[model samples]
Target: MMSISSRFAVGIHILSLIEFNKDGISSSEYLAESVNTNPALIRKIIGMLKKAGLVEVHPGIAGTKLARQLSDITLLDVYKAVNVVQKHELFSVHENSNIKCVVGRNIQDTIIPILSTAQSALEKVLENVTIEDIVKDITEKENLDKRHS
Candidate 1:
């Protein structure tokens, strides 16, 4: 099965980290450490987020920060910012199926609507979830872990 690009998740991680560590500088190196990936990769994704107006990258060690409030930015924003999937391409139908076979000839047509609906459903869910929600969940989990520890 084809998987969505990891860039989407990484983009979310970058934003969450920024908010999670708002007091500290969220330089590419810092984000890279939290993400356990190369700083270059983090910077690249940050660039995408910046382009989408989701983040602002500063010069020198000032690092990066969210361009908008957490409540105003939804998961859908991140999803779109990262360009996780091409426009209207969440689902792909195989092309050039045998036109002679009834199933093959009708397969793409039959699945297009279903696929479109599925994609819309997914986007709807993402749209409803904001970065604040994600950060709150993370903070709650951290508190819970600390209590247990």
Candidate 2:
């Protein structure tokens, strides 16, 4: 199974919660409750988002909130900010395939260029999407859930 990093989703979720709460300084405990994650993990993600300028933390009693408008932020921005694998190929052939096989001998080298192109294409798509898009999606999903209930 291919593994996906949680940073992108988690960061977006945290930001969305902050946005939904309307500038309310959400504590790590509350975010952890919403995310079903440990407070320590929430704190860590918060720190990363804070460094990326995606969110702000008010020290002491008040905790955190988004630093800027959701529309101003893009999915690519969050992906990069949360430290997702950028410019990285989806898969790698760590083991050498049989050198005797014509394709195997050079497949790794040949794949690099293709992989680079694919990665660039993916990033291009990501750049076109923004946090506002995520928020809309989540809100719509929530509404659908409510209607079903």
TM-score of each: 0.89, 0.78
Which residue pairs show collisions in model 1?
Answer: none
lDDT of 2 by residue, 1-149 (tens): 86658978898888888888775658998888999999889998888888988888855756787788889988787888888685475656567689999988998888888888887788889899878888899889999999999
For candidate 2, the TM-score is: 0.78
Which ranges in model 1 have alpha carbons more than 4 Å from their true place? 59-61, 97-107
- Scored against the true structure, residue 33 in model 1 reaches a CA lDDT of 96
Worst 10 residues of 2 by lDDT: 86-95
TM for candidate 1 is 0.89
Q: CA lDDT, every prediction?
A: 0.91, 0.83
Best by TM-score: 1
